[model samples]
Target: MKKIEAFVRHESFDAIRARLADMGLPSMSISEVKGSGRQGGYTESYRGAKTTIFMRPKLKLEMVVNDADVERAVDVILELAHTGEPGDGKIFIIPVEDTVRVRTGERGEIVLASHPDDA
Candidate 1:
């Protein structure tokens, strides 16, 4: 199993989610996050004054899937979230040792099956 974590622009969330659904890859957790990458951050202008916005708002999407689905899921996110500019965001894949479904006492692959695509 694998866990795919993607940090994407907040504005691209809707489109990315829709694309994932179309590809039969639903079931994800989304969270609002703030951080800076290689660009370090940017500046904002308000009332003719400039302020340093050190941390930018981003959307974090997390999903656990079978090993076979990792590549496709990563591709879908990358394709849909790209903006051809800095701060477009990044994707990380981590190995998942185990998973459990609390309500039904299911484990491993069985837990993943509860997700839309796995079902």
Candidate 2:
């Protein structure tokens, strides 16, 4: 199994979510995150005062998928998240040792299967 973590622009969330859903990959954890990368920070003016903001708001999406599905999931994210600009965000793929279902005590790749209750 593999865990895919993608940090994307806040405005791109909806479209990315929709496309992932269309690809039968609707299950994921989304979190509001603040981060800084090569783009660094930008300056903004308010009331004639210039302020430098170091942390930019982004959406972090996390999904665990079967080993065979890693590329498919990553492609979906890349297709929707690309902007050809800095701060377009990043995607990290990590090996998942195992998964467990709390209720049924299920483990391993079998836990990746969709459960009716998960809907």
Q: Per-prediction count of colliding residue pairs?
A: 0, 0
Q: Summarize candidate 1's per-residue lDDT along 1-119 as a digit string, tens digits.
A: 99999999988889888887777667789999998898754788999999988888899999998887889989888888898999899999999999978887888876765455354
With candidate 2 superimposed using the best TM-score fit, by how many Å does residue 118's alpha carbon deviate from the native?
A: 6.5
Once fitted onto the true fold, the runs of candidate 1 whose alpha carbons sit more than 4 angstroms away are: 114-119
For residues 1-119, what per-residue lDDT tens digits would candidate 2 score against the true structure? 99999999988889988987877677799999898887757899999999999998889999999887889889888988999998899999999999998988999988886667655
Q: How many pairs of residues collide in model 2?
A: 0
Best by TM-score: 2
Error of 1 at 72 (Å): 0.5
Highest lDDT: give the candidate number.
2
Lowest summed lDDT over 10 consecutive residues: which window, candidate 2? 110-119
* Clash-forming residue pairs, model 1: none
Off by over 4 Å in 2: 116-119
Q: How accurate locally is residue 119 in candidate 2, as Cα lDDT from 0 to 100?
A: 52
Worst 10 residues of 1 by lDDT: 110-119
